[model samples]
Structures are given as structure tokens and as C-alpha cells.
Target: MPRSFLAVSLIALALAGCVTKPRPPSHLGATVTVAPPSKADVWQRVASAADAARIARIGSAWSEGLAEARSRGFGDEVKKEALLLRSGAALARPAPTPGSYSCRMVEIGSTPKKKVAFERFKPFFCYVEVEGELLTIVKQTGSQRPAGRLWEDDVASRLVYLGSLALGEEDQPKAYGEDPARDMAGVVERVAPFVWRLVIPYPRNGAKLDVFELTPVTEQPK
Candidate 1:
């Protein structure tokens, strides 16, 4: 072979080796240690892969579970995070004490109409109690801004999502704040108690679940 030809062949062989070099197990299939998806990722994936109805079902269950968990006095950050993921929102209000009241709700879509309920802790100004599927803590500050537009928007979005899933092509655009048709806004009247209710069978089952109360309980004795 000619010297120049031999040199070119050697260079080509070297280049081929470089191109075919083995990768680390972490970079290769099977052996790769892929990081588990985050909570947000799971939510997005559920929303994306599953049909809208399935997503709505899961969202409802998830919301219901959150209310139950939080009511049971689970103070871990994950509990709060789970609630937030289920379209839960809290408005800061000053309690009679130094603490604050957080009102949360879940918007559930069912046949005939959509149901909205307080998860627990409506008159959160006086209760430091956490029960099964409910939590009410008294805040020192008496009058803080109620969870105004923020809570309303959160609930509205939940309704919109559920509506879209249930109604399919008839899904309507969301209207936040005072608008009735767009927002389906519900008032937090003292007569009603908590802001969220555990209405409708969860997991879309035939049977109904517990009706959680958001009423504030008397301060627990230390």
C-alpha cells in the first residue's frame, strides 16, 4: 500500500474507534439510573397521558385525600404541597392570636352541577384543632384579608379543569373573581361552616365519603 494511503486508513480507523467508544452505564440504556420524576412531573404526566376524565377523577381523589390528610393534623410540608397541587389556595388572615388562618377548598364536578366545598378550617380564627379529614387552627389576628381573588381563582381553575374534562368540547373559559357563570363563585357564609366539603363519591365510586368540617375548634390544651 502507498504510505499516504496507509496513513489515511489509520486515521479513519482511529476516528471510527472514537465514534464507537463505549459510554458509561449511567448514560446507556438499562444500566442508566434515571432520576424519578418530581411531583409536578407526575401531575403533568397524569394530565398528559391519561384522558381528561381520568385526570379529573384523580385530581378529585387527590384533593379529597389532601383535605383528609391535612385534617388529620399532618403538618409536614408534603401535606401542604399535596393540597396546593390539588388546586388548593389559602388566604392569609390575622387571627385573634399571633397566628394566621388558612382557608382551602376543593372544586368537584358532578352530573347536573358542579359542587364546591370548604376542605376544612372556614372560621379558622378560633380553632387549633385537627381531626380526621379536617384541620382548624386559631390565629391571633382577628381580621386579616380573606383569601380573596387568589382563592377564587384557584377554585375557578379547578372547576374549569373538571368542567373541561367532564363536558369535553363544551369546556368554557374560566372567569376569576365575581363573575357567576365564568367563576361559579361561592360565598363563605357563617351558616355554611367550612369552605370545602367532601361531597360526591370519591374515586367516582358509588358510595359517598365523610363530610369534612372546616369549623374552628377550641384551642387545644397544651
Candidate 2:
């Protein structure tokens, strides 16, 4: 062959050799083994001992107020005032010994209000160590707004503790006059091993009381 033809043939062969082979496609249906997260990895530390104790006291007072209100069949105004007094006293008293707790978001209870869905709320389950205090803090979750933004701009309470008790007021929509913005209390009773019931008096007079039946997130289907 001519020198130019020979050079062109050699270049073509080198280019063919340099071309990379195509890789096989990955298996779309293949099972992926993801190790479950370790307890340390999943548990989040959100509050210190002092903070937890203060919150607990506030919650306890609220719970007590609710119980009293229900027993007396008090009106809305009476219940609200009672809660205020209880919460104030709780704060003024000497702080109790601080306790430690590990908290994680759990399931919320169902509600009739169409605007508010319990599933959307990311409530917390706190396993406490200060004299065996266990409580749950129910708060709205999955909001597009930035962190630190208040849920619905309403200052209602949602702290429920063991011993069939809870401290926190129910949230009333804006359509209703201002949210009570008070610390209320109620009962947290265990219906089953993993199932719990939360009962709180309705903030509005003559309205039906609120009841929440909650279960762990692990029990929910994927």
C-alpha cells in the first residue's frame, strides 16, 4: 500500500482500540440492603435537663388545670383562667431537678377538622430519665416555611406525658377568635401496649372535648 494509505489504516485501527465498551444496565428491581439506623444515629437530643424540667412542670400544671375544668364542668372563660393560674404557679415555683430525655417524632391522632390533619403533624415521643418521665410533644410538621416559624401562628399547647396526663392547649383556627394561647392539661391513657389515648377538654365552651388515639411510627406501613 501507499505510505499515506498505510498511515490512515494504522490511525483507524488505533481509534477503534481506544473506543470504550458500553456497560451493562443496572438491575432496577434488585433489592437494596440498607442497614437499620443505630439507636444513637436515630435518636435526636433536642432539650437539656433544665429545659425539659421547666417544660414538664408547665405541662403538668396544664394537665391539672384541664382535669379540674372537666371535673367542675367549667365554661371556656373559667377554664382559660384556671390554666393561666396553674401555668404561672408552675413557673414561679422553684425549678425541679432537671431530667434528661431522648425524643423522636411519632404519629399524631386523628381529628375531624378538615384543615388540620394529624398525620401531617410530627409529634415527638420523649423517653425521659429524670425520675422516669415520658412525654410527647405534638407539633405541626411538613410545612414549606423555614424552620423556627410557628405552626399556624397559634400558641396552643401539645405536651402529653405518661401517667395518663398531658399539658398543652388545643389549637383553634383563625376563623375562631384568637387561639386560647394558654397552657391546658388532660389525660394520656394507654389503651394497648403500643396504642395510647389523649383526652383534652375543648377550649371553647359547649364544644365537644378533643380525643387523640396515637400509635408509634414503626407500626405504620411503609
Candidate 3:
């Protein structure tokens, strides 16, 4: 071989040896010491496309749910809970005191396929606790419990909620993205003194709005 050709081949080999393979974004498919996705990151993967859309357009839930209720002749019922049901009723300092709470579920609105425009379940027990940089809410008494963290958002008066349902006697529920059917998303706000509501729009159960009102349980002297 010519000296020049030999030199060129050596240079090519050296360049090839220096090349490196790119790293995957998620460290995907690498099982050993795999880094689990953060709770904040699973919202997109776990929530259904339609549900995500509903969360994105949460502003419409008030008008739409109320409209559905009024259309079905539930206006008076809605008017009765005016403060808690208002769309922009969130107050400043939206954080809730960490303690047990009395929670209730109110479902409003329906598609033509179903006739349930408004339904309110009896009060149940829930608990709020501090979790790292977020606050967590867990339904303490119910066949279907909701548990999730409250994330601070750009909005001033509300915190975004990303959670999943815990069924039966499960100790720890699957993470949000682990099950699409279990994933739940909503916004938490303080609508009245010592009162907050978690409003979920376009709930999978066919309701346009599913509001959970939470009020702290007063501590009594032992």
C-alpha cells in the first residue's frame, strides 16, 4: 500500500474509535438502576387524551356543567352551593391544614347518553398531609379512595392535583401513569374559610364535573 493511503486508513480508524453512542432520554429499556419517572412527569402518560383535554379546558367545566344542570332543571340545586361551586372563587393561600377532613362528592352534568345531571354523595373522611415539596390528599373512608399530591402552579389561587384511585384495601395505589383508568387530575382551591374543593372536569364516569369538597375535622380535646 502507498504510504499516503496507509496514513489515511489509520486516521479513519482513529476517528471511528473516538465516536460515542448517544444516550437515551429516559434511559429507556435499561432495567438496572432504572430511574423511575417523577410523579409530575406521569400526568401526560397516564391521563386519557380526552381527560387531559378536559383538564386543559377546566375553565369550561363550570359553564358546561352548570348549563347541563340547568338544562335538566337543577339550577336551584346548583345555586344553593354557590360559593363552593363558583368557577373563579378560589382564594389566596390555597394550602389546606394537614388534618382529617369531611369530604363529599358532587357530580354534575351529563352527555345525551346518560341522564344523571347532578348527584351528591354523603360526606366521607379524607386526610391531608405534607409530602416533600407538595401536599397530599387521601380519601380515608370509601370503597374508592383518591390519593395524590398538590403541585404549585403558575396560578396564584390554586394548586394542581394529580392523583389515582385506590380501590378496596390496597395499601399503596399504583402511580398515576401506571393505570389510565385510575389516573385523576384536577385543581384544588380554597373557596371559603377552612373549606376547599377539588374540581375534576369531564370525569370518566360521564359527569362533566366531579367536585370534592374538603373541610378540616376540628380537633377535640381528649
> Could you tally the backbone clashes for each prediction?
23, 5, 0
Rank by lDDT (best first): 3, 2, 1
TM-score of 2: 0.25
lDDT of 2 by residue, 67-184 (tens): 5444444434344433222333222211111222222221121224422212112343332123233223333222211011011101223333212222234242121112223232
RMSD of 1: 18.2
lDDT of 3 at 5: 98
lDDT of 1 by residue, 18-49 (tens): 88666878645555478976533433432323
Model 1 misses residue 97 by how many Å? Answer: 14
TM-score result, candidate 1: 0.21
Using all chains and alpha carbons, the TM-scores for the candidates as numbered come to 0.21, 0.25, 0.76
lDDT string, candidate 3, 1-222, tens digits: 899999999999999999998877776755787677664455556555765677788988888998989888888999988888889899999988898888998999887888789888998888899988779999887689999988766676877788899999898777876888888889899999999999998878888899999988875212
| Stretches of candidate 1 exceeding 4 Å from the true structure | 1-33, 40-196, 199-211, 219-222
| Worst ten in a row by lDDT for model 1 | 145-154
* Prediction 3 global C-alpha lDDT: 0.85
Residue pair clashes in candidate 3: none
lDDT of 3 at 25: 77
lDDT of 1 at 39: 34
The total number of steric clashes, by the backbone 3 Å criterion, in model 3 comes to 0
